[model samples]
Target: MSEKKNQKEKLWGGRFKGEAASILERIGESISFDRKLYKEDLEGSRAHAKMLHKIGILSREELQKILNGLNTIESEIDSGEFVFRSELEDIHMHVEARLTELEGEVGKKLHTGRSRNDQVAQDVRLYIRNRILEVLDRLDSLRESLYLQAERNIDTIIPGYTHLQVAQPVRASHFLLAYFWMFTRDRDFFQFAASTNDELVLGSGAMAGVNYSNDREFLASELGVPRISPNSMDAVSGRDHLLQFLFAGTQCMIHASRLCEDLILYSSQEFGLVRLPDGLTTGSSIMPQKKNPDIAELIRGKAARTIGNLNHMAVLLKGLPLTYNRDLQEDKLALFDCVETLLISLEGLEEMIRELEFRPSRGERSLKEGFATATDLADFLVGEKGVPFRTAHELVGRLVSECGEKGETLFTISEQARSAISPFFTGKEYDRAVSLELSADKKNSFGGTAKARQIEQLKIASESLKTSSRTKE
Candidate 1:
């Protein structure tokens, strides 16, 4: 008799005189995608039922029966034996309807002191939290793969670029490690996003606190959330956590897109700085001899989609009056698509990086063509001749200009540099500036492209990957 309190013969139909139109039924349904939240919904229900029983709203026997019904419903849905009707509107409705069918009126009491507003918020938070853990694990694996890639190229030489022009000669390991750090920052962002979602938000019923004396901490611990939300009104309408995750995803994609763009250029016939593995490339439809960087190109464009999705989600959250609006329903699609895009993009980019081969000879030669060591030449004058840097820079520029006019290289015109050395200089010092290998070696400042510093960086990067993350469990 208690289970039937205020219970309508047709559930929510007690408030309406007639059934909804067929078009309204179709327009209002979310079972197509929100059904993915069934597991989250079921888990939250179990926690709620246990809490309700402890607080004496649900008797022990009633709790067991309700839980059993929920378990049966989960099995049916997981096994694809349960049918979702559009008229049911969402996962919460379909799940509650099935629970009532299986356990009689006692199932109807399962929703006591709760509303779909708070329930959906809790379900989506759990979903994002769990997915963040998955992405973190994948990032760890990708970090390991990057460490291996850097190790293989520890002694390899490459031209480091600035503004798409070769700027300096560097150990290829250093180049790879730059990306390793980029991903490390992305990993940090994901950890922060996960922390933001770790707070449970389930007891806030319909923009206000639930009527019963609900133990939110107990519910949060049962649900594996580390904390409970502080405000009921904010809890019911919160989408900021989802926004933060999408922002992190967009940033990760931007990092990957930068690498993809580089590989696309490097794998082209003109650059030939690196070669893409055949498995990751596609051939041109008409040009039989052409192997195209289609994967890189696609991943690059997908980055834009992730960015657009973030922008779109921000627009949806903006101007909302607050406390669970219908517009919030549109968020799941953008968040889901953005998360999926980053996961695939990250994994694919890691594989491409792992398999690609660098052409050391071409990269080494490019260092010369772009005057990558021009600054090094100036530094040499400052160090050896005590020449003020500005004067040395001008003197080197004039000397380089003369060499360019005669179609000569710095390597072939060491005498010009010797003649132009400051009053404190010797003729033999200019010889060191001409060698690209030595030019790179002489840049021994910390974080420089010097081989020794890069080797030291490789060790730091390796240790970074090995250390356990500080992320909240």
Candidate 2:
């Protein structure tokens, strides 16, 4: 009895006669992950078949048979009954082989003028477009979480930090809005990435123009692709769009990771500025007193992994030639892994943020140790006493230095000493200048630290998120 030659041997036997080595097959196969692209693949194929029929390349009867077979294949795959063979090299070949088994000769016509190069590119574009929307929705959910937290804590006071040292009193709403702006910028980048790959590369063939005068525009419109790629060679070979996607994804993860780091630090017993619900925290096996911020820690850790994946892809593509190469196969794992990591991280962050609780007084207490109100005192000297800003800043620096030497807060300094150190000072001036309450209230600029402005910003952030969510739906 003779063993059957696998689909790969049959598909490319015109150039090579031997079967692929078992190790080669394992290393080269992408069915496990590329199967995720099956829906996008089928969608592209349907549009291509219709265009082929319209152009008289494939008969209407053949197109019907191919489309029917594709639909059946989609159902089988969706129902988990589809047999994905690794010997097929990748999901594209597995799909093509399955279609051939189902429709005989008509299945072969699916590849008439199309190359696997363009086919893969098209599938990726379709997948990225949908994934961008997925990312947008997740980010919007996060923004909503932030907005709600901001609204609830509009008047709650926390100490804002610079270099991990208390800088000034700030409303909790202002802090949440900081993250809101981060995500808003991330959403903009996601939108830009989606548009970057809007062009259809399906009819470009393998690094060269197609021989047949097929209606590429008709196929493009059918697939909802925004435009046609300008250069056929570049279209088939370029993974810059994927690179853009990775960049956007990495930056978003970085933002999320930074937030996670802050949350973890804030929730620590030492800081005690925030609390993780028992449902969201984990306990150590050996330490009864520990309710660790595991979710935030994992998010922070995964951000590193996501960024490393993006860097791996960038290095992979750096020295490659203009046309397609087998080296490009590494892109699938890099891209798919980044997408999965980002989605998980985004959703997990949204969950954690929704349940987050802040200890406003705990955050406020941080200011007591660090002279957080020193800047405010300087500004007060400049405004109330007509002291030049430079003079006031120097005087405040001297005051802070003196306070450190005497082991006292700015408010504890003697009025005689303050007046002696700076001409701007007077009786009871230290009491008025170092008050956190006054500092917070005096910040009345638009988007300032004042509670009123912070609440206004929260309302705007909440409405913006609501508008985005409605538009997406």
Candidate 3:
């Protein structure tokens, strides 16, 4: 009788007469990580219990008891007094087990119209939905930081690079806004991910519809979800929502990684275009004069982890059979890690951007050294001298080569060399063409690097931030 009671306490152990192997318990337990879903799990139970009472499967008294019990458990967990046991296998079981202890057999009825399969699915959707909002908020903050810096530096010029080589002069605002746009797209991706997870899947019991006439729409409403899953089998089995979220996180992190790369490179002594805040950097143990951009470097490295997590989730879902399987337990490891990584990275990157200081003089020096205005000179030939673009390009290329061979820059190139390249190239025309400030300002086309266009872009970005904030509210 005692053995039977123990087996019964296992929840799904009714079919078995033998005890589970200890090793099986060790390998099968998910309460360690899935405990992060405690709030979602408890909330799901409260909704499920209320739905059970609505369908007359549970008494009003039982519903009240279950709700009270769940509330107490939530407090216990919140106060760090809850015990997480591997023997319970997962959060669902732990929650149910605790509820049963508190409310007697009525606690068992909490699982009446649903299974852990759909329960976990619902919890993950809730988790993803909440995390998407957080990511969007962080992205918004970072975008604002970028916008503010751009506004402050509208007149600041920097060398824009292609293939890691300086290609042209651009407003610092333009350079910063480039990242602002990348994160804007990342915010859109996260919003899509949130939409994908909006559907409530709580009514999907295991892999099939339950016998009870439960009101899933009510459950959806209680859970603050906008829609209910249409098909039971797909609802419990599908992991597409999680995949979309992971993909969004991966893309956001990739954008952050790119930003970090620029920060790292620009902060280096070799480039010296920007300086990281001391609070965001670290000192090397062996070097007395080293203030390393470790924060940015770590964010970049963690992006690889987010990418790997996305791949991990994709491969985990690839060969699985329809419906929930034990392998699904592995999903939270990647999901939780990616969420944590992305949130911290976003915060770190935002702080870094907020504190970053740009050296305009260094940027101007790099532009001169790299012949960053060569294209502008070429354009001058085409636009001013009526030289065909191909001829202008060739002429500029020759001038650049001659400057390089003579150990001079465009700013230092002699009048003799300018005449050798093109008879139209006088010292005044060449100087005007190569002026970094003039080159940047001349790009006055829509979305160009000119101060006028950057001001327009900043206004647009500020409006976008306002819209996003309104939507968030």
Candidate 4:
């Protein structure tokens, strides 16, 4: 039967005596996932065919037939008419098989000097290169969402926390800008990954140099890459570019998960710092009052998978003494998974952030009980009263404890009780020292949460976003 012959007719089966068992064939098959690389495979093949024709490997008539054949195959795959066969193995083999079916001998000549090893290397680099640019766009969109949100809430003050306890008051814009900087770094990493993919690996056939007079640099230009791999062995064996993308994806996911964690906490009724939009939240089936931050919670949980994928690839390559090994085939699994996971998380978080509604009043009013301005009081004592910092710290600590015991704010403390520690203490000075607005304004050093500094940061970030967008950075 044709099905029976298909198993023994594999491209690499010339030396084998028998067909692989069905289970082994199923185990080795990558068509299920690597089919996603069809576009890159087709692109590389066309470039290879053109290079062959330029060097007189194929006649003018044969090159035209090859081009038409490849175009038809690409259309078939794009229009959902292409049939993927497990027997053909990966995206590359499938494309070649279809090309041969279309153009006979010329299609067969397409693989004249290239090996699947180098072919797949090129395909992965191309795919990752495209994905790197795509992820940067998403990151920029998310940054824009945060930027607009920060602009809208520029003067809105809310408690800032350290160790889960309120430490000081800051503009809501200042808080949002923190995430802008985090993802800016992530964008830089993706750009680095893009630069790493600039080398061509297509001419490094089967882990050694090919015999053809192929123009690797010309092929690089056709593929929009800047250079060719220097050594064939390293070109075929190296996967550091894929690793760079995976590592960048993992770090981005980590940052996104941390942002989601903050969203989860802020949306909770206990904190009530932000309100989740009804469309982005879920309600409990049993509890009438339950509204959950399900999207953010899911993002938080998905981070473990990305972190695991990064580790999986790192460990997969740790022991392989490879010029090229069969084990490398599984690298696509991690790369594809990490890329998709990060994209989904980025898109979802951007939507949630765009719809987020902050409840600044609730957070602002809680600053007194938590003594968020205590440090300001200490600073005033140190500068105005010349009290030793440690002495001022101890004095503030005792007063804070006493206020808590009496179920009162520092402003409510008796003047006699406050002055007992220092002769310079007075009601006016105490009120000014404990003022939350003055406390935040006092943070005027660079990168601080002072309102003026936040405005300056916002202007710089907005301009950076505009420049990067125009330049496609």
Q: Relative to the unseen true structure, what is the C-alpha lDDT of residue 440 in candidate 1, on a scale of 0 to 100?
A: 71
Error of 1 at 185 (Å): 1.3
Poorest 10 consecutive residues by lDDT, candidate 4:
1-10
Please list the C-alpha lDDT of all candidates, in the order they appear. 0.82, 0.86, 0.90, 0.87
lDDT by residue for model 3 over 277-300, one digit each (tens)?
Answer: 788899988998999999999999
Clashes by residue pair, model 1: none
Prediction-by-prediction clash tally: 0, 0, 0, 0
Tens-digit lDDT track of model 1 for 355-449: 89989888866776667777887887788667899998987787668768766656666563547544423345665765677877776898776
The TM-score obtained by model 1 is: 0.90
**Candidate 3: regions farther than 4 A off:** 1-8, 388-391, 416-423
Task: Give the better candidate number (2 or 4) by lDDT.
Answer: 4
| Candidate 3: C-alpha RMSD after superposition | 2.5
lDDT, model 2, position 399:
84
Which structure is stronger by lDDT: 1 or 4? 4
Ten-residue region with minimum lDDT total, candidate 1: 1-10
Candidate 4: give the clashing pairs: none
The C-alpha RMSD of each candidate to the native structure, in angstroms, is 4.6, 3.1, 2.5, 2.1
Best by lDDT: 3
Model 4 TM-score on a 0 to 1 scale: 0.95
Measured with C-alpha atoms, the lDDT of residue 462 in candidate 4 is 93
